[model samples]
Target chain A: MGIAYPIAKVKGESADRIYGVKGFPSAALVDASGRVIWSGHPSSVPRGEIEKALEGTAFLPRLEGKAYKKVDKLIVSREYGKAHAEVLKGLQKDSADETLQGAQVSIEALLEKMQGAANAAVEGQDFGVALDTYSQIEKLFKGHEAAKLAKADAKAVEKNPAAKDEIAAWKKMVKADETQFEGDFEKAGKLYAAIAKKYPETKSGERAQAFLSRHHM
Target chain B: MKLLGLALALGAVLSGPRAAKVEVGDLAPEIYGEWYLSDASSLEEVRGRVILLDFWRTW
Candidate 1:
């Protein structure tokens, strides 16, 4: 009953002031700007509205402030490469702007986090996670410092003699993720089991191990 | 005396932040309290997300 992100809970009276709630089980669907896009019981929120809001909604906010006003549009749309190039150009002209600096810092940190996790996966013999993580970073940060580093990391993983076999076994991991997200538990479970059986001693395998233990699949 | 105290408590609750009315399409007011079950410490961390603030109580 979980999604890709963590659910946050807050116990406070602040909920009372949000439109002065009228009854028990009041729910409000807010967009990124905190506007009440929908309000009512959870059941009443339209499914299409949720899907529409979810489009291009990544975990990170677009870099804030108007310091790089032109690039702001690009980042919001997830045109990272164009934004990256624009930010670089902005940084050259005015190096002191926090908003301009944010673009570099945020993406670099994200890259570092992924690259570090990939390295750990490789060390733990989870070649599937290692390759997938590196591949994503290599693609995601195409015009950033992380792209080169992820490529180098991918090459390092490829050097391992067991890398090919282990990575091949875990190839369906993405499909498992998609199925799980789609709520196709039976299919996802089978995919996970297949991956786990193929790459028995890795982190990717442990996904199936954990899923089965939790769901009794 | 007990009834007086209850009246005063209700008055205080009604006079608090809940005094403002919230309508659809209006910007939501700040929400905060003891947070749990999340990696993000503040709403700012989840800025890009569509947040559903649920108000519930244990029956």
Candidate 2:
């Protein structure tokens, strides 16, 4: 797929979790003002709808109440980072809104909850989950104590052989993809072959083997 | 102590309100992450441009 537009690889499906994207191949059109004018399956969205949104006319009705309700729902779901992003985006439009202000309070409460969950995951020896949760916190609330703790925990987890190998393989896979994307097939092939050789049982390694077999590299 | 903290955290999440699906007319959540090309950009940077956030995963 030759996509001319800029693309981003969201680290760890955080965007999916925040946007509540249950399935892949989803599309969202954001207006100049940072409002999501339309969202749905790519095939379902009308081509004209995107054009109209870009033109700043024929927009879906603004529903502040409904937006707040959605934020509240994220709070209930313990999607603190998503809720925080929602309120922060809302604040971008109107910093003085009382409802958004109130949502901020709830966001703080949720962060505390997140910290507790991460800590619990660590105590339970669920280093993977703990590492993921901590990374989320670090992304959402940079410079916070919880983020710091998460960083420290990640370092500790890396000391474990299993965790270390998993992380290394993941990083290598990402690097391989990036190299492939940059049109350096030779370099990508080397990385993929290394992965396939080192982590033969892993899914990524399997994918690398498949890629190599397909390209006969 | 960690177990107690986890319980308390779980309690807080359970006690909080549920979030509904965000749809059209909702403020777009800011996109933050490393860019595949060039320096990373945020929703704020492209505030006035038509942004088609095409989210994908490589798994």
Candidate 3:
């Protein structure tokens, strides 16, 4: 059946692995900000819940007891970035809750780790890795002072001509893969060939060349 | 006494740590895979729009 809404195939069993979805017909209503406002069997998700979440007025349950337990698991797994976001969303529901104070400490530690990695990459002259790590920090911690600094650092790395060209070529390769996934073989083939022609020495270009040759293009 | 032990065991299994059940107020995990009938896209690509994620499989 054709779908009017945007749809994506979950990579491998990622849905099951990441979201704990155990069966088919599962669904989640994620807000524009990427936070899931409701999740369960599709039919159990109310239309009003979706509307309220979109309006930023949905009543969120307190993050205590069971919810705190859930957050703790994420912390132990070192999914601190996710834990921080989840805790922040919980704070929005109940800003005065004292349990969230503990969560904040873990979030701070994770941010420090991320910053350390970015700094080390810069010291090693791995501008691309530094830029990527900083961009991730900016996205995950938007509006934070650290995220602001990350954006600045990423821009500085991009200022280097070699780094800029490398990033540009990598983006084109990603676009080519996207095109192939969309089932436009002809367009994808041409994009791949272009990368192979223009950036033959790069890893992505080498991959493109291999794909074209294997596919007899 | 045996029934009480079984009940406790079941409770532990049910409440034990597992992948957190995604629910309201949690961030949607990024989804990546092959696209069907459209250009490959991502949640970040459609950040401003309301998304209805339809999870289906053709058996």
The numbered model that scores best in TM-score is 1
Residue A28 accuracy (lDDT) in model 3: 65
TM-score of each: 0.52, 0.38, 0.42
DockQ of each model against the real complex?
A: 0.19, 0.17, 0.17
In model 1 chain A, the worst 10-residue window by lDDT is A1-10
CA displacement after TM-score superposition, residue A106 of candidate 3 (Å): 4.0
lDDT of 1: 0.60
For candidate 1, write residues B29-50 as lDDT tens digits: 4444444555565555555567
Off by over 4 Å in 3: A1-102, A109-132, A206-217, B1-59
| Runs in model 1 lying further than 4 Å from the true structure | A1-67, B1-59
Residues A1-217, model 2: lDDT tens digits: 6534555545544455445565556677777545666777766766786666555421111225765887766654445556667778889999998888877775576577667877887675555556666776776565445567768777787787756555566567767865653335567779999999997765567767876775666
As a whole number from 0 to 100, the lDDT of residue B27 in candidate 3 is 45
- Native contacts kept, each candidate: 0.48, 0.44, 0.41
lDDT of 3 by residue, B1-59 (tens): 00000000000112234433343443455565654444335656554335556455443
Q: Is candidate 2 or candidate 3 better by lDDT?
A: 3
| 1 or 2, greater by lDDT | 1
> Tens-digit lDDT track for model 3 on A19-77?
55555666667664555666677778677866754543211223457869877766544
Error of 3 at A94 (Å): 15
Writing each residue's lDDT as its tens digit, candidate 1 over A1-217 gives 4443333343444445434666656677666544557778766867776666665243334665555567877765555656777887888898987777877676556556667788888887888778877877766667776778888978888887878767666666666755653335567678878887886776667765666554565
Interface RMSD per candidate (angstroms): 16.6, 18.3, 16.2
Candidate 2, RMSD to the unseen true structure: 18.1
